[model samples]
Target: MRKILVLSVSAGAGHVRAAQALVAAATGLHDVEVVHCDVLDFVPAAFRKLYAELYLDLVGRHPHLWAYLYDKADRAPREAWFSRMRRAVERLNTRALHEEVARQGADAIVCTHFLPAELLARRIAHGEAVPPVWVQVTDYDVHRLWVQPGMRGYLVAGDETAFRLRELLPDTPRIAVTGIPVLPPFAQRHDRAACAAELGIDPQRTTVLVMTGGAGIGSGAAMVERLLAIDGDFQIVALAGRNEALLAAYHRLAAAQPQRLWPLGFTTTVERVMACADIAVTKPGGLSISECLAVGLPMVLIAPIPGQEERNASHLLEQGAALLALDATALEYRIRRLLADPALRAGLRQRCLAIRRPAAARQALDQVLDADAAR
Candidate 1:
C-alpha cells in the first residue's frame, strides 16, 4: 500500500474540510493509506491555543485588516523569516512527522493549506528528502505565496485560477486546474423535499440556510434577532459552526419563534443542508460558495472578508448567480426580494447550475495520479 500524508491547519474550518474531502476521495482508490495531521496540533498547547484565539480575533474583529494582512503577506517576497519560524516549530513536529513518513514510506504529500505546504517545501529545500509535495489551493482566487518553488504538484480550484497562477508564476510546471476538491456527498443527489421533511421543515415555504462560517465569526445573534424581527414566515435554518455558545443563545432566542427558526451547531451534514435549501445566506468563503453551487443553492452573500472574499462575491454577482447584501438589514431585504420573484430566482438558479462543478474532487485525484505517474 502506498501512503499519502494530508496536511491541514485549524485556522479555519474550510482548510480542514478541503483536506478531509481529498483524503476521502483518495482513500477509495486502491493501495492508499491516508494519514491526516493537524499542523497546529504538533505545536505547544499554549502556543496552539494562542494562535487559534488570535486568528479568530483578527478575522472576527477586523476582517478588513486581516484581508490586508493576507494581501500584504502574499506580496512580500519569500524570505527566510517564515522558513526560520517553521524550523522553530519543526522541533515540535518534525520528529513525529518524520517517523510517520518513514514508517508509512509516504509516496506523496498533499497540503490543502499554505502553512503546511510552506513548511514541507522548506523542509525539502533544507534537504529533508520528503516525498512529493502537492499544494492544493483551497480558495477561488490563487495567492502567489502558495507557489512554493520546488512543489511536485499544484492543484487549483478551477481553470481560471490555474491560469491566473501561471501568469503570476510562470515557472511552476506542475500546476493543474482540478476544481475545488469537494467531497462526494456534495456531489450526490438527495431527495430535497425528503431531506426537508426529515429536518422538520415545511416543503412549501422556501428554506434559507444561514451560515456564520466555521467559528461563527459574525454577530449571528444580531442577525437572527433581526431576521426574526422582520415578521416573515419563511423557514430559516441558522448554522453556527462549532459555536456552542452561539447555538445555545440562538436556542433561547428561538424559543418564541420555533416554527420559523432552526439552529444547528457543529455538524457533518452541511452538504445535505445545502442540498435541501432553496437559498443560502452566507459569507463568501470560497469553499462554502463552491459547495452551495454544487448543491444548486443560490446564495445571498453577506459579510464576506475584504480581499479575496470581496473578489469572490463580485465574481458571483457578475455571473448573476448571487445576490449581494451588506449586513443584516440588507440581508433580510435581499432574502425577501430573492424569494418573492420567481423569474429572478429561476435566472439566478440557472446561472448557478452553469457554474456548478461536481467532478472537482475526482478530477483533483486524477491530477495527483498523473503527477505520480509522471514521476
Candidate 2:
C-alpha cells in the first residue's frame, strides 16, 4: 500500500477540520495507508502551546491588531528577510518535525497547514530526496506564509487564490481549484421538517441559524437581540461555539422568548441545525462557507475579521451567495429583507449550490494520486 502522510496544525479548528475531511475521503481506499497527525506534536511542548495560543489570543481579543499584523505579513515578499528569520526560528523550535517527516517514509505528504510544508520545503531544497509535498490551503486568501518553495502542487478554494499564488510563485506549480472540503454531513440534505421536529422548533416559521465562529468575532446575544426586532415570524437558532459565557447568555435570552430562541453550544450536528434554518448568519471562514455551500444554505456574513475573512466576504458577496451584515442594524435589515422574499432566498441558495464542491476532498486526493502516478 502507498502510505500517505496527512499533516495539520491546530492553530485554529479549521485547518484540523480540513485535514479530517481529507482523511474521511481516503478512508476506504485499499491502495493507500493514510496517516493523519499534527505537525505541532513533534515540536516542544512550550513551543506548541505558545504558537497555538498566540493565534487564538490575537484573533479573539485583539482583532484589529491581528488584522494589522496579518496585512503586514501578507504584503511582504514570500521569502523576505524577516520571513526567513521567522521560519528559521520555527525550524529550530521544530527540529524533530523534520525527522518525523522523513521517518514516516510516505510516498507523498499532504499538508492542510503551512508550517509543515515550509519545514519540508527546506529539506527538499537541500536535495534530501524528501517525499513530494502537496499543500491544501484552507482559506480563500493566500498569505505570504503559505507560499513556500519546492512544493509539488497546491489545492486552493477559489480562482483568485490560485491567481494570487501564480503572482507569488512565478514557477506556477500545478494549482488545483478544489473548493475547501467539508464534512460528509454537509454534502447531503436532511429533511427540514424532520430536523425541525427533532429540535422542537416550528417547521413553518422562518428560521435563522447564527454561528459565532471559533474566533468569536461577533456577539451571539447581540445578534440574536437585534434579530428579535425584525417584524417576522421567525425563530433564531444561535450557536455559541465552545464559549461558555455566550452559551449562558443565550439561555438567559431564551427565557423570555422560549419559542423564538434556540440556543446551542458546541454541536457536532451543524448540518442538522442548518437543515432546519432558512437563512444562516455567520462569520465567513473558508470551511464554514464551504459547509454552507454544500448544503445550499444562504448566508449573511457578519463581523469578518479584517484580512482573510474580509477577502472571503468579498468573494461570497460577488458570487451572489451571501449578504454582508456590517452591524446590528444592517444584520436586522438584511435578515428582514431575505425573509420577506422567497425568490431572493432561492436565488442565493442556487448560487451557493452552483459554487458548491461537496466532494472537494475526493477530487483533491484523486488529483494528487494522479500526479504521484505520473512521477
Best by TM-score: 2
Q: Which ten residues in a row have the lowest lDDT in candidate 1?
A: 212-221
Give the C-alpha miss distance for residue 130 in model 1, angstroms.
2.0
Best by lDDT: 2
| RMSD to native, candidate 2 | 1.8
Residue 65, candidate 1: alpha-carbon lDDT: 81
lDDT of 2 at 255: 94
Give the clash total for candidate 2. Answer: 0
Report the C-alpha lDDT of model 2 over 99-198, residue by residue, as the tens digit.
8877889999999998999888888889988888999998888988888889999999989999999999967799999989887788887999999987
Overall lDDT per candidate, in order of appearance: 0.77, 0.87
Model 1 Cα shift for residue 162 (angstroms) = 1.1
TM-score of each: 0.90, 0.95
